[model samples]
Target: MTDEFASLNHFNGARDTPMPQDRLRAIRHGAEALREQLLDDPPVHFARSFDLLRIPYPAWFAFTGVYSQQLLKPHMVHLLARMAVVQYDDFEGRLRTLLFTPADFEAGNETPYFKRLAEKTPKFLHKAIAPVYNTVPQALASCGISPAQVDYITYDHLHTQDLRRWLGTPGLLPNARLLVHRQELASVRGLLPVQAEWYCPHGLDGIAAERIVPFDGSIQLGRGLALVHTPGHTEGNHSLVYRTGDGLRVSSENGVSADSWAPLSSRHDGIRRYAKATGAEVILNGNTQEGSTDQYLSMVLERTLAGTSSSHGFSNVVPSAECSPHWLFPGAPTSHLWGETSFGTPLHA
Candidate 1:
């Protein structure tokens, strides 16, 4: 109602004004420039990486339509959110921190807001162990960094967040801004009040409008990262594109797991047969109302091994580092295991 939803892509330049081909060309040019800079002068490069866990989830939740009809084996298998902390150098040659949601939720006597919300929510989620958080501050401190050093904060989508705790009425990361999709902010109204508890109450309310940067269509984050419009998991769902030394990597929840994104990695005979029959390389994020066709195309935009039997060998955009927060759990299903993590070694200055 803040005129954000009333007008599509109202805040930034908004992508609709330009022709589709022109926009695509601009994106390609920006990507090429960023790639050159990163590989040569390196305006933005991965500094280091760390992970934090929020709440544990069942394996079924990681894949769409898998175990939906009934519980599969490995009932004890658990899944949790892994917050990836990535550092970079901005175009100005200043060190910048970009946190992809450290999750930062807690349990028991740790956090009252989420604890209360959990009590009111359904019993299915209650089965997982209480969340593990509250160490995020110490974790940052150990890195010789503080919230103030952070430049940008984002999530794949606003499925759930405790961001307001650190990003308060005044501020925690004093200089940081929330880079999110305009459609995501617009879609919140349709979800809240009905599914209100899923969101942190007034979490984003106190933050100033300028502190929140919303945009439409495909947009570049600085010179190195591009946030692509891949709307399926959530109405405003987007993916983070980073040009790595290896290739272009994408980070998103559109596919709940690696196997979901790369069906060729699957060992399930049924899935293999289905893939063989349909040639579908992608699967759904399981919780969205958006169709799988769009999700599949989005997956196609992602990168995988070249010339492999399972890969299309066309995309330079590889799936970013993603790991289940509960990969260490005993008796965990094979599907719950992560094939790769976003954790990176230090980049040389």
Candidate 2:
């Protein structure tokens, strides 16, 4: 078995490192659970009984290391594997959808900086490698919906070039809007070193910026609602909130993966507290263990929000750093949701 497969198996707690049947079974089980939960409850606000469907965007590739720097070393193969779930209504209406930013398009492209990185950093060969297994086109095709019909494209923090490629892709809906934090757009313009590559020249075009709408705190896309929760990782990093039949679901795409749904306090205190206060039922991550999502959500919700704890104590308190005008208050959800605010006291409903 390859070292990579072995590592993944070990991480997944499989007895056999190579081709771990246990790991695959666990993954299948989790996928089935997610599908069942999504279908049974329909994770959106359905007033009455309605038909529902989910499209899985499989992970085609990943960077070897964890840190952004390590993953960024090879300029060519920086794209990460991602997936999306599109939910439709009984009338075959596109209610709402969530998708990870497609980052693979930047691989093997001949950008000036990428060329320089390849020439100067020969040691970073692993970084330049593309997905050895699944590819994005195949994953998208698997959804059975032509790419052109896709209505909304929700990205975490994709490089400008990658976003351009995705936007240019034939399958995406032309009028489909791009959702991201306002600060992220500004950060892209500022050319900050930390996010230098993310700022593609394409984003510089006023047209590109025009096509992109700034997600102040929350915005309702065709069928889904998006939330802007900027953690320190990036100035504009945000999470997404979509209403499902079960209740409101929050996708911590950048903050957590599908597998780690531990109570906010146990996994990430700030995010946990924020999600709990906001009444988010499911916490989906960008990545995770096969069974972690079900386990974490089940345990954490039972102990935390569903338990006898006081929701009033930490429920509504927004840290000064994370405040924004559009942030939902109990009674007053924003109408013109845009702009940022200073780190001040919590804004109560």
Candidate 3:
């Protein structure tokens, strides 16, 4: 990975390299510097520009709690799933096409961990709680993109993801390959007890090694896009960074909503009090507190990288699964909903 676009901090090395507190300070400084650098001088924009397609899917109510520290009203959240279509010129000047976060909603339901929750839910409310919105491929087609045009596929992390249908046995996208973090691939191979529940047991079973592109740290794809390693949600979790017309935006599952990173400005009940009491700047997604401190720092990195959004009160770190306000979820309103956004021209058009 190039030093210019790579993560300012990494936890892959020796345990407690400098201790969590010390590392946090270093990351904070690095993030601020990078933010200023980007402001002073932005990176080259993508050749044909990039496009984003966001689709909402139903997610459990209690799981979207702020920091998962406190409980909110019990209701479902419309989790927004994003599909970023990027076209850029490589070093060799070859035009490359990437399909980021083409998540399979049907396959995702098979996760053993979520299955346990489904089994416990009353049968009458099953369809209401988890309804089908649209598949990734379907969403792509709506935007005039075909499956064959996808050159690469990736996600912030592989939680509840089943790649067998996409890259493994079924061969859904003929020319597409998976770009994943080395540590993330390892974690999927040998599941950790805490993270195992969210992953499908046989997700990557038949995928050939050649179909996956594994790398360490962070990597910049051409100019406008970079994948920054922001571990904390999972040992291998990373966030998607891209230059948008609005500004730089980072997408990850680290926090569920804008209220997550900027709790002090949030109108949600108890969130501001919670932040003040704990001296916390950001709220954890809380579903998997695998690395709380690391996640917090990683979020800080994301916040710094994207900077703040004038439209909203917090940084432009868009959660892959953003929480949308619902009548059922009365008191737990979201600060913003980046719903079904489109930027640049359609790839197929």
**Which of the two, 1 or 3, has more TM-score?**
3
- Local distance difference test, each candidate: 0.52, 0.35, 0.68
Off by over 4 Å in 3: 1-19, 36-71, 75-78, 122-124
Cα RMSD of predicted structure 3 = 4.1
lDDT, candidate 1, equals 0.52
Count of backbone clashes, every candidate in sequence:
3, 18, 0
Judge candidate 3 against the unseen true structure and give its global Cα lDDT, from 0 to 1: 0.68
Question: Which digits, one per residue and each the tens of the lDDT, describe model 1 over residues 1-349?
Answer: 2222222121133233446445334434443444444334333456333444434444554555555534244443344455455666554555657776555454222333345646776767554454443355665675567677777878777766655655666666777778778888877646644345345544565667777878776665544555666665666767765555454556676665555655555655544454565666665555445545445544544433111222332233322323243533454323334432453443322
For residues 25-94, could you state the per-residue lDDT of candidate 3 as single tens digits?
A: 7777766655554444343333121222222233332233343555354444555555666665444545
Q: Clashes in candidate 1: how many?
A: 3
Q: If both were scored by lDDT, which would come out higher, candidate 1 or candidate 3?
A: 3
How displaced is residue 85 in candidate 3, in Å?
Answer: 2.8
